[model samples]
Target: MQTTQFMITPASGKRLIAKALINYAPVQSALESGTLVIIAGTTNGYLAEEILSSIGQLEDFSREKFFRGIVLPPSQPRTENGRLFDESGFPGDVVIVDGKWKKGLTIFDVADDLVEGDIIFKGANALDVHKKKAAIYIGHPQGGTILASLRAVIGRRVRLIIPVGLEKRVSTDLDEIAMKLNSPGAHGPRLMPVVGEVFTEIEAIFCLTGAKAEMVAAGGVAGAEGSVWLAVSGVKQEVAVAQKLIKSLSREPLFSLPENE
Candidate 1:
């Protein structure tokens, strides 16, 4: 098999992920025939951008900044020195499709009417690679939207798709981490175990390039931090396609919360 390798910046990764989500057969079907609710985090914001741009609706939302759902550090980013979503929630940006109706409904409203084919796109804070599980951080006293969204996901069997990057990988067991983390434990940020269809850069490559991608190396400096170095294995044509697609997404703009909203 022909093998190809390259470095994918975080911004490019997000763009590839957005295209993958849009191309996913299940996501498209649900959006067309059923409900496809998107709970936007930083990464999912890119997915939203792809969806909007696909329909030529990018002008509807502020292209200047991303409307984020729940942001970690949930405080002012040290790098940007500005608060990212001062008061974030799961209602950041939703594409709720309810049969003949389509609108941006609240998480609570989406939760009540969820069904098996419905899709809940939620981002995570960390991923346990060894166990193949992901985790999210919760700060709300009531455990936030994750608590409520679980009911529909676990009870109703709705598809919970998490769009996260490789930069957030964790080494420990997510269950143990969550058990020890609680909002009242007097810690910085509480961890919550989330079970869902984990979609990371690995999945994005396959979805975007139709090639098998493996993480070979990671980490970089000089604006390359949070990048994922991947080794792709496939037919010659597939490898070339992968290369072209990745290069096309290399300059994706970073997702940021609105300066004033």
Candidate 2:
């Protein structure tokens, strides 16, 4: 029951989650013999890099332009879909099959081909950590990638993994929030409550190092904005491993948005 505390910035947390997911059982299984789709988002960008690097196919891949939509500062202009006005440089989603990176492909390109035992990794905009629920914001008239991924996930038993950060956590029930946001009178992006395995920094720490982690507190200034204070506890060896792993990511460079994004 040895416990250790660590401060994890959002950037470092993304790296930690990415490191953990590379060793995830379902991810490993899908990489070797099944379809694994990594939907483009800020968090998934990190996971994509880790997964791609593990298979020696990291070339030509950059997180800079990996996202389809993004949340920018108040001053930054964005479309109704939360995407930058300019999207000419956007790359397609990361779709890996049989351990090879299928360059220039997206879920739509292979959603019909996916079946049971396949896995999809998508990012989330809101998370109900206590209830283990996650949801995404949709500005598309015909739903979005979640709809595409759901055809296989709910209809064909494909596994869906939601990789999100603790910073995105919300205290309200997602369904309730969805009700308000999706209302006819509501303005801006609608919320879609999704069902999947919610993987956060807590889960990431456990997955990678066998240590239990809890978000004890949050917030900071300077480079610590959106940072979380994690209290990790477990066996002596596991806590040691968690400490080392967190240390390795403590200096993960601050993620920067590409020009005009």
RMSD (Å) per prediction:
3.4, 1.3
TM-score, prediction 1? 0.86
Candidate 1 local lDDT, 188-209, one digit each (tens)? 5688888888888888888877
lDDT per residue (tens digit) for residues 32-125 in model 2: 9999999999999999999999999998899987888888677765554567677788889999999999999999999889999899999999
Query: Considering every candidate listed, which one attains the maximal lDDT?
Result: 2
Sliding window of 10 residues with minimal summed lDDT for model 2: 76-85
State the weakest 10-residue window (summed lDDT) of model 1: 78-87
| lDDT of model 2 at position 190 | 91
- Please give the distance, in angstroms, between residue 237's alpha carbon in candidate 2 and its true position after superposition: 1.4
Error of 1 at 191 (Å): 1.2
**lDDT comparing candidate 2 with the true structure:** 0.92
- The parts of candidate 2 lying over 4 Å away from their true place are 77-81, 259-261
Query: Per-prediction TM-score, please?
Result: 0.86, 0.97
Please list the C-alpha lDDT of all candidates, in the order they appear: 0.74, 0.92
